[model samples]
Target: MKNYIVASWILFIIGISLLTSCEKDPWKFDTDRKPGLYFVELADTNEISFDQLNDSTWTRKLFICYLIGVPVDYERQIEFAPIDSASNMKFGEEYKFSDAILKAGEVYCNVYLWAKRPAVEDEDGKRYCTFRIVENEHFVPYMYSTAFFQVRVNHPREPKWWDAEIFGAWSEKAFQVYMRYYNKQEVENTDNWQKYYSTVYGKNMYIMNDATWEGVPALFLPLLKEDVLVPVFDYFVANPSDGVDIPEWYYEWKKN
Candidate 1:
């Protein structure tokens, strides 16, 4: 009887442990949780362009935009919408923007890839395009198409900020700092190309580097300052290919 009791106790303990372990393993969605900025890949459809349309009537639909890290308040956020109209296509027909509530802090923007109309000349001599939003059964909120895209936020505006010291110094001192940081022998050796590539293009690279060398000033300048390290790191981490061999003058000047 004692032996049976002991065995029963062991079984009970094992069951409890299993239950506890199962509880700890919560279900999770496959998403990244970086603190800022993200990109979402969109499906390609010919309907998003103006050339494919039979008539002047074309429309673009805004689909979904993806979130990268944690959510933030949208109240203070500013959205910049740029349409690709290089093909002599009208812009209005190619894109429309809309929003939907997913969960608290998690919202979605739908982008209709290729619904466009032809251009109409207005009385002021300016060309215009027409677009419409339709509700479809597959598309939630009926009569609208939705998809996700990559997005960036909290990005920097100044590329020079990464090399702020160089930007601020008198010409000689500034040049000296630039040479010290960018033209080191360690940087120029082509064998380290892999390191540079890994830094710029590797997955999650954006989170790794915070120096000014990482950013594209043209894109980041208006958003952030030169002294902020986070944006610089993000830029270099995402673009290691931008790394170059340190110039010969950098080494010579440093030796001097």
Candidate 2:
């Protein structure tokens, strides 16, 4: 009988705690809160991804929700400002946002974002921007914050197991061609190559020390053939970069 009373009390306490936690849970989307404004969007919700060669612009729909017991009698304009310093993609050139309007009797409104590709691909071709509300007459900025957008590039990186012997000494162009032939992309030796090659861009690249590459060569033997290098050499012959013109080693391979 005593155990039953004790068990009942324990259950009662557990139920009270759960009710309290639910009341305080920030993610609990309750409409009965004190009047406030908040964004119903995630940090990466506004991203624009594109292939530089194929795509130019992307349009996205976004939203803002708030708590109000009564319907707003008139339309209210919600304004936003670019977090300028955080924005990498330029305003007039790469992106544009139109002010959104909250119509009468509506709890939410739509926001539109348009993104344009950069004129020339920057090294990684990735850019970012953030936006936040500028308070207006109807309502002010809320607890939940800002909108973020990214123009992120998705280019393949050279595999960790990339050995210069297979690609015939790595050049930016040569690696680009090699990626087409090689199917595997393991993260095993990425750091080893960086240390072994000690590559400095357009400078003292590839300090060929046999000892540095001695132990791991057999384990990470890159797939290669003499003919596969033909396209690599051909790409450079057709289109050479201004600064790091084709290396002599590629030509040497062509002659032999």
Candidate 3:
């Protein structure tokens, strides 16, 4: 009977141990913990416009952060392996990721991808690159973040009229018309012609050469439609002889 009681006690202890082992640990899949890998800007593909080629390269940023719960103090070395078959954009040819592998020891860190110029320009062709962040020893990548790792290159635009010598004479005439009306208004607020010129074109035209205006539009049409500036500009254009006559279009504009 003593032996039987001892066996029963042993079975009870075993059952308790099994129950304890089955309980979920606080650290695993904790509700409060939200550790993640992410991009700072959420887009499936980043766009590069070779047409607006003012700079040598275009850049985008990637970030990794702890959302709700911080993991144990640890550092991770991130890796990006380009999927060559899936992309026409070649690494070391068209693009590269900067600051890719490093110790991510803080709350958040940055990784950058740079796309270079003379990007394979095609009017209707698709040019792109897909890069993937592989699994590393320290952190598991969020699948959503990995899916959108892409860069798309667009075709450059051909040079237009604003890109030639015609722009200089046209800008001078437009500025002359603006000044003529300014003197007639008799409103002596000390705003200079350069400021007025900047307002008409949205940037300082004096500083920009014709080659820099390749994709830009002519200033006259936009200035001719402006409410305050156009009335004066229209008057001078219609009455270049310094007469007191207002055009029918000005009266019509004022009536409305």
lDDT of each: 0.35, 0.56, 0.49
lDDT (10s digit) by residue, model 2, range 16-101? 99999988898766556434456766567665654422222454445555634455688888777788887887776677776778
Write down the TM-score of every candidate. 0.23, 0.41, 0.45
Worst 10 residues of 1 by lDDT: 147-156
Clashing pairs in 2: none
Model 3 residue runs over 4 Å out of place are 1-23, 30-46, 50-75, 101-105, 118-120, 123-125, 145-256
Compare candidates 1 and 3 on lDDT and give the better one. Answer: 3
After superposing candidate 2, which stretches have Cα over 4 Å from the reference?
A: 1-35, 44-46, 51-54, 61-69, 119-125, 153-256
What is residue 115's positional error in candidate 3, in angstroms? 1.4
Is candidate 1 or 3 superior in TM-score?
Answer: 3
Candidate 3 lDDT tens digits, 202-253: 3323333333433343444344245335565455556563323333545455
